[model samples]
Every structure is written in C-alpha cells, then in structure tokens.
Target: MNIDIYSPDAYTTGIPHEQFKWLRDNDPIHWHAHPEGGGYWVVSRHADVITVSRDFKTFSAEQGFVLVDDLPGDILDMARNQLLGMDPPKHSPLRRAVITRFTSRRLEQLEPAIREIARGMMETARNIGEVNFVESLAGDLPTAVIGSLLDIPRDMWPQMRRWSDLQTSASDPDLGGTPEEVNNASIEMGTYGFQLACERKDSGADDLISLLINQEVEGESVSEAEFASLFVQIAVAGNETTRGLISSGMYELIQRPELYRQLEQNPDLIPGAVEEMLRWTCPLHYFRRTATADAEIAGQAIAQGDKVVMLYSAANFDERVFDNPMEFNIHRDSNPHLAFGHGIHLCLGANLARLEARIFLEEFFREFGGIELTGEPAFIRSNMVHGFKQMPVRLLPR
Candidate 1:
C-alpha cells in the first residue's frame, strides 16, 4: 500500500498504524515525495529516529526545524531563531540560561499551585455533568500554569489560548483560521511578547520572561526580536502539546474502563500510567530536521540539505524496542518514549508537562467517581499535533 503519510489528510481519518509498521519493517528510512517540492527521508524505527535526533552535526534544525514543506521566507527566518530551531554553539548557551527554571526542583515547587488550579477546574467540571472535556477541562490549566510562570496577566490568558490553538491546529476546521488570520495571530502575539519583554527587561522579576530578557548569551542579553520568537514558542509549545497529554490521555482511559479501574485502585501507579499514556499516544507525529552533511542511515544515503523527518508516533510502536507494542499496559516499565523527544533540542518543558499530566490524572480519578463518554471524540486534523479538538463526557461526583 503506497500511502502518502506526509499528507495531513492521512491523519484526518486516524493514525495509519499498520502503514507505519509496514514502513518500519520494510523501509525504516523510506523516501517520501513532497507535493510542494523536495522529498524527505522518513525515519520510522526507534533506533534510527534516535540516531537522527542525536547527531546534531549530521542533522540541523536551523536549516528547517520539523517542517517537510518549506515555510515562507519570513516565517522560516523567525522559526530559525527560536530555541527549537537552532544548532549547537548557539543552541546550548541559550538553553542553559533558562534550563534551571524548568528543573524538577523548580517545577515540583510549583506543584501546589498546579494542583490548586486542577482542583478548581475539577470543582467546576463537577457541576456540568456533560461537557466537552477539551474546552471545559483540558485546555485551561496549561495556559494558566505557563501564564503564571511568564507573569502574563490572568485576564490575557483566554486570548493567549486562542492564538496558540489557532497556530497549532490551523488545518482543522474545528480550529480554523485563514492563512491571513494565522499570520496575523503570529504577528500580534510576537508584538505582545515584545511588549512584555520590554516591560520586564529591568524589573528584576524572576519569571521565565524576565530570565530570557535579563540573562546574557555570551555577553549580550536576548534581543527583543529573539525574545519575541522565544515567547511565542514558550506560550504555544507549553500549551498545545501538554494539553494533548491531558485530553488524549483521558480519552485512552475512557475507552479502556478496565485500565481506568486499575488506576483508580492504585493511585501510586499514576506516574507510570502517565508515561504509558505518553508512549501510547505520541502527541506530536514527527519533527523534521535538515541534513547538514551527507549521512547514511540503515544503508540509505542522504545528501546535505535534504529534509529528514523523524516519525515519533510510528517509532513508539516499534516491536524491536517495545514488548507487545500494541498493548496498553500501565505497568509497562522502562518506557523510553520519544514523546518529549531525545536530544539537546528535546522538549524544554518535559518535566513540567509530565508533572501536569500526573497531577491531572491523580486529581481527576480522585474527584470523579464515574465518568463516561457521551459523544464521539474528534481529533485535530493537523499531523503535527495529535490531540482532541472535542471530547464530550459526563462526570459523576464522588
């Protein structure tokens, strides 16, 4: 079966699992033709994806981070400046300037605040028995947490969520924005971000925004334009993907009542359960890297400047790395899922995302004695983000 996995429509129906397995087994480093222009090598196996993610010299994000189709020149230039799209010698120092804030100790300190936010959300959810879980519950906390961290005023969060939702899922009608609308959102968001950075530039605030504005790279602080890109990255990246973890993770539980029961019986298992959920639902399908030098993977030669896409959702199910890869077992130990990725460009918010998911599950199972799906769950159409746009469910108070 010759399926165009690159097409976002391929994911509109659902994740093509069997096709990914076929690619992994037959052509782990398969070549896929892009309708717009150049072709890219699809790295489907876990080991191969790791190799491409690790060898920064061989593959470069600055060339074009995680995009198979080339973006417009202006958009591409801004993307290259973000931490997610930079190469070494440049990526390392910028990352170091802010890594300390996202460490386990720092995030753990924010647990009480996160739990308070989760508790309040659940309390509100208790009153509305039947609701769209995505809008009502899953979407708010990530924005709240990140907003608090950035010192963005509470009043501005709704708009922040709207911009992020539009930017991340532009292809889905449920979350549609015209190309012009999408571009305008980015411009407006960046402008707002620049304003925030300037306000905090010398205020001595300890939030993430202040750190980025105040901290020096080599000898110079981050430029306003650079911080604008970083701000949008942090705001959107922190919200959408982490919300996917909560929404998609809950969807998995509702379908598997047996697993849900098992988790309810033993709460301590939640940390691992969150890990299993992450492995089972690869939130982001893939991220593209450009080959900076000629390299061969699984005997397939790739030329410099070629696009190499790492298929995370497909690689997570590789039988070679996962035992009974199709089965969902919460007790599955030693899960090395690439949901947060596996390199220096690895998700900076990995710890915070995990903490939020774990705490969310703990609070959810504790608050709702019974919950059931009332309508079909709909996934966002974009292949980049694997998340629910709408999931209707009824909740019963304890």
Candidate 2:
C-alpha cells in the first residue's frame, strides 16, 4: 500500500496507522512525496525519532521545519524565534529563563486551583448534557489555567481560545476561520500580548507574561515581539493540545468501559491513564526538523537543508519499542512516547498539559457516572495537529 503521510485527507479520515505499521516494518526511514512538489524523509521508528530530536546540531529546527511546505517568510521569521523553533546556544538561555517557573514544586502549588477549575468546569458541563464536549468543557479548562498563569483577564479567555483554535485548526472549516481571519487572529493575539507586556513592564507582577518580559536572555530582555510570539505559542498550545488530551481521551475511555471503570475505582491510575491517552491519541502526528548537515538516519541518506519529519504517531505504535503498541494500556510499563517531542524542544507546556489532563479525568469521574457518545465525532483536516473538531457526547449524571 502506498502511504502518503503528507496528505491532510490521510489524517481527516483517521491516522494512517496501517500505513505507519507498514513503513516501520518495511521502510523505517521512508521517503514520502508531498503533492506540493518535492519529498522529505519520514523517520518512523522510535529510536530514529529520538535521534533526530536529540541531534539538533544535525537536524535543525530553525531552517523551516514543516515537511509538506515551507512557511511564508514573515511567518517563518516569527516561527524561528519561538521556543520550539530555535536551536541550542540560543534555545537554552530562553528555555532556562522560563523552565524554572514550571518546575514540579511550582506546579504542585497550582494543583488545588487547577482542580477547582476542573471541578467547576465539569459541574457546568454535567448540567449541559448532549453538547459538543470540545466547546463546553475540554476547550475551557486549559484556557482558564493558562490565562490565569499569564494574568490575562477572565473575560478575554474566550477570545484567547478563539485565536488558538483558529491557528491550530486553520484547515478545518468547521473549527477554524478564513485565511484573513487566521492572519487577523495572529495579529490580534500578538497585539494583545504586546499590550499586556507594555502594561506589565516593571510592574513587578509575577505572572508568566511578566516573568517572560523581565527575563534576561543572553544579557538582553525578551522583546515585546518575542513575547507576542511566545504568548500565542503558550495560549494556543495550552488550549488546543490540552483540549485534545481531555476530549480525545474521553472518547477513547468511553469506548472501553473496563478502563473507564478501572480509572474511576482507582483515581491513582490517572497519571498512568494520562500517559496512555497521550500515547494512544498522540495529539500531534509529527514535528519536522531540517537537516543542517548531510546526515544519515536509520541508514538512509539525507542532504543538507532537507526536511526530516519525525512521525511521532508512528513511533508510539512501533511494536519494537512498545509492547502491543496498538493497544491502550494505562499500566503499560516503561512507556516512553514522543507525543511531546524529545530533547530541548520537548514542549514547554508538557507539565501543565499533563496536570490538566490528570485533573480533568479525576474531576470527570468524580462528577459523571458515565459518558455516552451522542453523535459521530469529526476530526480536524490537518496532518500536523491530530484532534477533534467536534465530539458530541452526553454526560451521564450520577
């Protein structure tokens, strides 16, 4: 079977796991042709993905990451500045400046508030049965958490969510806006972020925004432009990907009552459950890195400046690394999935996302007795982001 990993339609129908399995078994480092014109290497195995992620010197993220197509110049410039898009030397300082704030001790302090947010949101969701789980609950939790962290006003959370949804789901008509609207969302979000930075400049407020604005990167403060980019990154990622973990997670769990019951009976199982959900659903399919030097991956030759896409979804399901890689086992031992990319660019919001998912599940079981899928869910038409556009489900009252 011919596997076209670059096709958005390939993901819209469902993740081409069969194709991924074939590639892992047959062509571990497969050359995938994009219809746009050229082709790039698809690194399918678990080890190769880690190799590419860790060896930033060889596979550069700054030189345009996406394999399907190159980003437009202005956007590319902005992307290269993002925490995800920068290479080491420059990447470390900015990352270090903010990493301290997300440490486990800090997150532990926020757990109670996060739980309160989760319970409050679940209470509202339980009341509104037969709703789009995406919009009603999953969408709201992370936005509130991230907004609170940034000290963004409560009233603006909805707008922040809108901007996030638009950028990530731009290809999905039902979930996203027009091209003009997408551009406008970015400009408006950045403008809002810039405004916040200016207001908080030396205000001595201790939120993520203030911390970002005040931090010294290579003996220089992070500029408003950079803050705007990081703001959009945090907001979108916190909202979009967390929403995926919660909603997609429920979708999977509801289908397997044993697992659902297991989690409900033993809340301690949540952390493990969250890990499995991340691996099983794998919110994102791939993150692209550019070959800075001609490097060989899994014994395949890659030229300098060539695009190399790490197929995370494929790697997570590789039987070589994961025992019964296709099965969703909450208690699966030694689980090392790359749902969050490995190494330096490993998502900045990884801990926050995990916290949100864990608490969301805990509160969900505490409130609802059962979850019933009321309508067929539709997925976004984007290969890069793997998530639902709409998941209509009824919350069963206890």
The numbered model that scores best in TM-score is: 1
Counting only residues 3 or more apart in sequence or on different chains, how many pairs clash (N, Cα, C under 3 Å) in candidate 2? 0
lDDT values, one for every candidate: 0.87, 0.86
Per-residue CA lDDT of model 2 for 337-391, tens digit only, reads 9898899889988999999898888888889899899889988898888888789
Stretches > 4 Å off in candidate 2 = none
- Pairs with steric clashes in candidate 2: none
Model 1 misplacement above 4 A? none
Clashes of each: 1, 0
Look at candidate 2 and tell me the lDDT of residue 211: 83
Predicted model with the maximum lDDT: 1
| TM-scores for every predicted model | 0.97, 0.96
